[model samples]
Target: MAMRDASTQTEATGPLVQFARFDNGKLRLFSAHTHELRYFAISHVWGDIGWRKIPGIDGEFLVSAQKVDFIVNQLPDLVGDTPFWMDTLTVDQRNQAEVIATVQNIPAIFRDAGKTIAVRENDGFYACCADAIRDARSIEEFRNQMFEHCEIHKDHVQEETYLKRLWTLQEILLSDTVQFVAIRGGNMDPIRPFSRMISTIHPLEVLGASFFENISFDCVLVFSKAYVMQEVILRLPAPLRTRRDSIYNDLFPMVHAASNRRASKPRDYIFATMPQFPWYHYPKNAERMEFGDIFLDYWEQASKNGFLSACKMKASMIEPQVRRDLGKSWLPSEIQPEPACLGDFLKLLGGQLPGKSAHTGTNIHVTRPVCISPFEYDHPSDIIEFIARMTQRSHFRFCLSCSTGEIPKDQGLKNIPWENNLKDINMLDWLQDVLGQNQSVLPFDSQAGNEIFSNDMRSQGASQANHFHPDELEVARDYLYTIFFYKNANPTEDNAWWPGVRDSLCRLFEIAPASHRLLPILLLMTATICCGMPVSATAWLMRFFIPIHVQFGEISHIGLLARHENLQGHPTPRTMLCVGQHLPVAPLLAGEGLHETFFPIPRRHDPKRNVCFGQELVLIDPEDRAPIGLLPDILHADMDEHELWTNIKILYDEIAEDGIRIVPLSDL
Candidate 1:
């Protein structure tokens, strides 16, 4: 066969390779710039890098020998003598300019092809599924058959290397029609209409049930689902494809879909995603841009468009080393954005307006430093220790005052009566009150009528019968007291509930604390609050005691704080506090108020320095009333901390008329 390449006039008129018949039964290629040519495009994984000579009409050309042999042998059984353009043969790999030019025209190439054939070597499981689906009458019956026979071939499908290549995503997406050819035993097993298989095999259905009892099968299910979603999203119209309401919403699934896929170059990970992001512009010198520079540009663009409005100055918890290596303070090398529930916290603080806007290119300004605290902790463990000491001291006093004895017996603590005479007798409301007055309480009806003795059953839809039994209240109250008073017992040793409570505390801190560090902190914080310390003071201690310096367009200091202690670290916590602005909302909700963001604070090698980048909490100046806007400064190691503190004290003194008192650390 002789092949021709289309001329490079434009992407539409760009070169297409044509294959022609040859007397010697070898392929020959020639360049042609015409719209009338019809060809199928082959999409396959490059299994081996080694090259071998493939016979052409004029001569022989070096190509991935294994890939060429596999495709040539399978072609007759797969597509049946249809001429096609395989990238390996069509694109000159040795010519850099040709590769770049051809890559830019890839979308057009795939879209113009008559059909896209995805070639994969058949493994036992895929073969079995294909065989079973041919005879099955319904999806449910097919699923049943798959479940029965899947175990034998499950490993092959889960570990399929073909699905884990990045370029294959674009190839699969751009094609109008795709057919799968599973090659096995010199025979091509045709899986017609690729979308049909995707629609039938749902990851949740296959992986959710533990019927398989295999971890690898579960993994396969997850990856397959991601692959399906990635392809489906790409097939949507361009306008609907990448235009998302928020960056957080769009970036997660996009990154997740491509997570396990390998790219030849690290920058290709970001570049491949560009086709999906219509709004994003590649740098004019994209070919020369460093991988880190690409990420930095992405962060800048996202910030200018208001994507980083809610981002706090926390270092990457999982990939701290990656962030450090990138040497960009504003960009997180790890792509996981803060969760959406953080926005709920912003609403509570009256910080952000509800709903997303297409145009949120607000100019955020970080103003002068308010108060930089002299107080600093060396590690999260140090803060945990401080909380534990405070808790133990408070618990000892409570136990000493108990009427039963110096320390209340377990039975006595369990028997503590619910004060029925209280004016507000609603169990839910009372529980909220006990937890913290700042905590939001779900309404009785909102709690599925869990209220044991509420006469108000109107919200229950005329069903007083559905109310909880009156006896349940006594049990509920006893359980609540046990949890509340468990602080007096030695929490570190033998308490079952303490571990759960500690895990909750670790979550509250946002950053993952070292192992065995959080339980004591939770116990202590609870004990101190129960011992009559103001909830606000305890909250400030946990959230706003440590200062974090943030830089994006400008450098500024922000303090981490939470409004409600009880709900502080719930996975989707109600709110997070930005002390610099005195803003309390979820981390995701900080977009409007947050102007300057900082990442990768100077790395602290000395444990005794008591300086950490992503600490859980920080202290905010009580009187720093700087208007919310962007500020300018780069936080360097040599920066004057003394001057920063001086500015903070000035701000504190200026608000003397407001009667706000700065609580000293020693007082706590």
Candidate 2:
């Protein structure tokens, strides 16, 4: 029978439950009001066996006599004669109103009950393992023996089907006192406490498929059941059992966990987890508010405020290679054919899965510093490509010119390509022609106006190779030197000039040799040196071209570069997150950031509203620190690079304390 809709039921009192009590040679059924909150609840997988008519019960929907005997015999020892609620008996199958009422309050039934006894009907392996390992003294000894037993009797291992049911996720998560028991051969076996089970089996289970070589598939399946059971226990609030307040932190994890679960009815996939939302209430008219709208309303509230904590924890835990694969701009929409689980997403990212945790919020209150750096790229694409090149996968190499860190380094520039017309000449000869002693660097000679850098500018932002006549050298060198020296040396550096030149370079070379854009920068540096131009010119331009830097506390090194898209004002800075902690497996923001966009996601509260994704924010190294200035010109011409870095650092630290401002993303 269908359950009654909200209008017929009071949300606070909820549906009435038929509780079964076994007395002296008799079993009696009595209805209990939910508000009394006295009965314990039973959560188990319903078997395929036909119903058995209890002598006094007046219905065909009665559960099997074996299950009734298992409950009557074993449940008393756990809860001591406490009346319990089971769906088959407690929910009226013949009445539609009672069914709807009971279904709507499924979450509350488990949550409000005095205790929840999770019954494993088929599996006897746990009982066998417990009996065999009863003599073990230490956890190590228990685990070793447990693994051995699982292997020896792998053929008989049965996975806990209760853990795989979609409805049971909430049943176990919402329950305060969840006791697991297995009914085997008309006997009951009490499962050990979650703490001991996790300590005993988690290490081997984490080894995953590799650990299954010596172990049988049945054994692996049983261990996986233990893993899922452990996952539910981990999500529950500890010390104090009921934490209605922490549901926001767990919402996304619940959704992801449900991906692996099975539901009898398709809509039950959504309905089962509905009670986990703290904002959810039993509606007066279930037909009035479509489930889609109700879910979107919940998603909107949850997506914006709570997930930063989980994102930060995941960011801190993931590896360096995974972070690089994301390359900063990865929003969830970018991944082709959405991933099903965290492991699937990590697999798609081409990285190893990290050690499993609940991925809950760390509750650390931190903030993201939003200070601007003087080094602005012409377009986001320029920086994206440059960062992509630094990775082991990309071909761009900086050689020895990179001062920020020694990376993308190779013995003196290897792949600098010359223009198509000059390809016949060796690169050395080409350089000599352009910068030889008698030659004047190309410049504006109105009559035969030479455009030596026109091809370079078109192909690479501000840097490209072009054939030049000896007479064209003077104007080209002078023009190059003016733009370089003025922008680098000007007390009031006009950040706008480079961005314009950078965009022009991108537009020109978008269709050029995709891999060789950086070649022109190196070629230009070589030209400056061959022509007896100042050595400082090469150093100055290198700083601008590779503007990004990263550090882990005092250790200055190249780690990962992320472009912050929240640009404001001139001289937009790409804020570098310096993780003093070990390298994380996922980019702090982008990994779960994809989940945020796609939906089905699952962090900590900051009373001050200053929580950030990563752990620490250290000062950038002075030796390699790039000059960063906020808009409206914060620097004076006389200021030294060290002093400019110091002032900017003070602001960085201050802004970090203020925290990042979270703007809710648009609906997916």
How many pairs collide in each candidate, listed in order? 40, 26
lDDT of 1: 0.36
Worst 10 residues of 2 by lDDT: 626-635
Model 2 residue runs over 4 Å out of place are 1-16, 22-29, 35-37, 49-56, 62-82, 94-100, 124-126, 136-139, 186-246, 250-259, 282-294, 300-668
Worst 10 residues of 1 by lDDT: 342-351
Across 267-341, the per-residue lDDT of candidate 1 in tens digits comes to 555555443443455566766655445555655555555444322222222122322322232233222211112
The per-residue C-alpha lDDT of model 2 at residue 430 equals 20
Give lDDT tens digits, candidate 2, residues 118-175: 7766443355666666665544565667667767765444444554455665576566
lDDT of each: 0.36, 0.37
TM-score of each: 0.42, 0.39
